[model samples]
Target: MPKTCFDPAASMASAALSESTLSGPTMGTRWAVRYQAPPDFDHGALSRDLALTVESVDAQMSPWKPESGLMRLNRSEPGQWVALPADLLGVLARAVQIGALSGGAYDAAIGDLVNAWGFGAVRDAPDPAAIRRAAASHRPAHLWLDIDGERARARKRMPMTLDLCGIAKGYAVDRMAQVMDRHGVAHALAGLDGELRACGARADGRPWAVALESPQEGRRAAHGVIELVDLSVATSGDYRHWIRVGSERLAHTMDGRRAAPVRNPVASVTVLAASCMDADAWATALLVAGPGEGPALAQRMGLDALFLLRCEGRLTEIGLGRFAAHPCRARIAAATPAP
Candidate 1:
């Protein structure tokens, strides 16, 4: 499906039963599946299949797993041709495309850089030289994929340390949705971490309402809510997954241009797209683009994004494209680009 622009008035929902929820753990986080189960559907078997699917994806892409496919590739020498599974290959391809389109803002090849920043399990700061070397290795520029053969190779001398942390969960959500579809289920809201995808509607005929969290630190309040059907939404924020590097606190999100986490004035970015993977990738890209360029870039790209910027100790929000129609829409911060 192509990317879509959300239209509130035009977006309606078809009714379906909402019953039987299943959830489990994956990729260091929890995944939930809320769906309308068919009468003949086996809830127990469906749950197992869903768990297995998520486990397979994690084994293929998780950097924390030493024996994972991505970690194996990372251990391989730069010139080595790694035989990638279809899932990893597809994610690499999409990551490369988004990285190129975002001018390296959405790079997946900065896995080593992330680890060096002590954002992984380690807490101490890494050597300065390692960080510099990691920054020099950009995924879109160096990772080569042979789509026809279903394998990929790295053209550079660095290891293939590609991290799918930003987008893998979204793909997992899509897979959950696929699983639900296969089992003759409908009206599902599948989510992993900060990404969510919804389809059809509840028995009451109302679309799923997703809450957007406020970007403030230590706050768990919802800033806005939007009704969505058959659409995926993802948000990237610096509020979580950050490490304090001496006096400076650095986020896990890395920017290839600076070879460091984005230092932009933006606090968070939420993107709505046809697919959860695209939404996840674009949310990171838009957050890295920051307030100055994000709104303009989002406008030009026809992307539906909601940006929360940190300005002078206060957070200001700006909505682009369809986000304007979101319920609880805040005052339009002046820095937002004109539509």
Candidate 2:
């Protein structure tokens, strides 16, 4: 179910409009779209179109596919330009922009680190040798990756592997929403994993609701609900994907500066933005920044973010921007410590 979920109450409303659900598998997870349509609406055609839209994204950006544009670019030699699809180039450009904005906290050149940590295509136990080698030779993607949007081409200036896992799913979700728009489905919600975008209000004229998951390692629970209207939400948490090492667990998300799994008190970070792509990338950047530096950065960037921290066996939350006014419902007995 990922973290974001539609409110069943609104979805189950039996109005003149009927609910149509479309779903398919992509990026090792399922994508779903729910829209309200008139009785005569062609849901079948819309479903097929939605599936194709996400498939196109997978084809261009998936690292698991050897023929994918991203993989081809990864295999290219330094200083060799590779003409890429517009969508891939756009995502790469945005990654570079966000990487610079986050002070290198968010990076797309961590493919080697992702694989070494067993979070990439080949899922195995973390390799100590690979981890050491990747850390020793790590560099931020912005410094080594070059993008020429006018030419729809990109090239690596150094030996680096590119990965788009942090933002690709959200971009796919955005593409799904665009497909719905093309089909004239105005009232809809589209999502991949925890990243979600709403085109408009539900059939009943209520804003679409998304649940925020509590960052607990062994279970799934809703920490809060956000009413979304023409907005996107993404959550990056340490609880979901991690590797256990003795008594400690290492998160899948890498801190580019450290070239290792993020080790901080921050358990999760949720961001709301106009685009799912921005929400997704910013959430990852803020999570890697942790409590010490995350809040300040979010404030400076004017991002709506909710940061959950695990302190002394209790959960603490610090909200900024819109989240500051609308705090999560789940509460612990202890007060939140200053970030």
Candidate 3:
């Protein structure tokens, strides 16, 4: 699970500033927002509107919901055109772009693989042939997007099982931040699961502090505290979302290249990008590239990243680019974790 390092000064400032925070259910997880607003801010009404906004996104993109808009599109036959909602089309477009950029390592077209691994709404033990077929079909390039009409069509051979699990939550977080901005709140912090985005700064003009957790299963220890200002942070880890199959722990992150659960030395990958959507997507991509190569990928993509690995119960942290800007206690561990 992701952890946040609470700054003591921020705690004291929280008491000094007039802040409003709201939390609610979203995307099989939860979302929370904290901002400095007017003393008479309509907390109840604003919270309700924000929750509905997230629910709308979930209805359009959740793979767990059989009747969701994305799921409905999944049910359509190949070569059939799907009149997708604006939001759904937007996400699909971004996913396809990122997939191609990462050489298919960050594909969002892996719903069948997700289901076969028992991580989706429908779960099944994947046979060898099914796994191969699923792996071969994870090419988002096969789907053609008509942005002008907000529609998408899959080629006859490509299965249209697009899974937005990695990106939707970040989009929701971005949407929530937009909602808050529309309501005239300037400085705010928002988060969904492990995806976090910040806008402006605190009332005292300091960055928001969040705890970065060690990638040790069942251990909620904070490995470092990051100060984010007007940027988004995301951590993708095998330990957080996984299944115990007999003696093996199967992670939710499937390698698009392998068409199987990723087997990398780095236990977790945290990326800081201009938007949460980019941070979220790239983290998964770099994690698949393995610890040895992930840092290079981040540097090439111009992303700031933090990676954690366990070697004989000792945790090692590696920071690249802007991740080194902060003087956290784990400052001098050599960069990159290798298997």
What number of backbone clashes does candidate 2 have, counting pairs of residues 3 or more apart or in separate chains? Answer: 0
> Residue 143, candidate 2: how far off, in angstroms?
1.3
Error of 1 at 229 (Å): 0.2
Tens digits of per-residue lDDT for model 2, 207-268: 78777888887888777788787899999989989988779888999887888889999988
Model 1, 1-339: lDDT tens digits are 233445554333322232778999998889988877545668998899899999999999898899887787778776667677888778877877887777677877777777776667566676688787776754443244323333354333454467788889988888888887788666788889979998665544457777777766665767667667888999999887787767987887987667788788888899988899899989998988888788888887899898887777666778887777644222223342211
The lDDT of each candidate is: 0.75, 0.88, 0.76
Lowest lDDT 10-mer window, candidate 1? 330-339
Worst 10 residues of 2 by lDDT: 329-338
Residue pairs clashing, model 3: 4-211, 5-211
Among these predictions, the greatest TM-score belongs to 2
Best by lDDT: 2
Candidate 3, which ten residues in sequence have the lowest lDDT sum?
329-338
Runs off by more than 4 Å, candidate 2: 1-14, 326-339
Ordered by TM-score, highest first, the candidates read: 2, 3, 1
Better of 1 and 3 by TM-score: 3
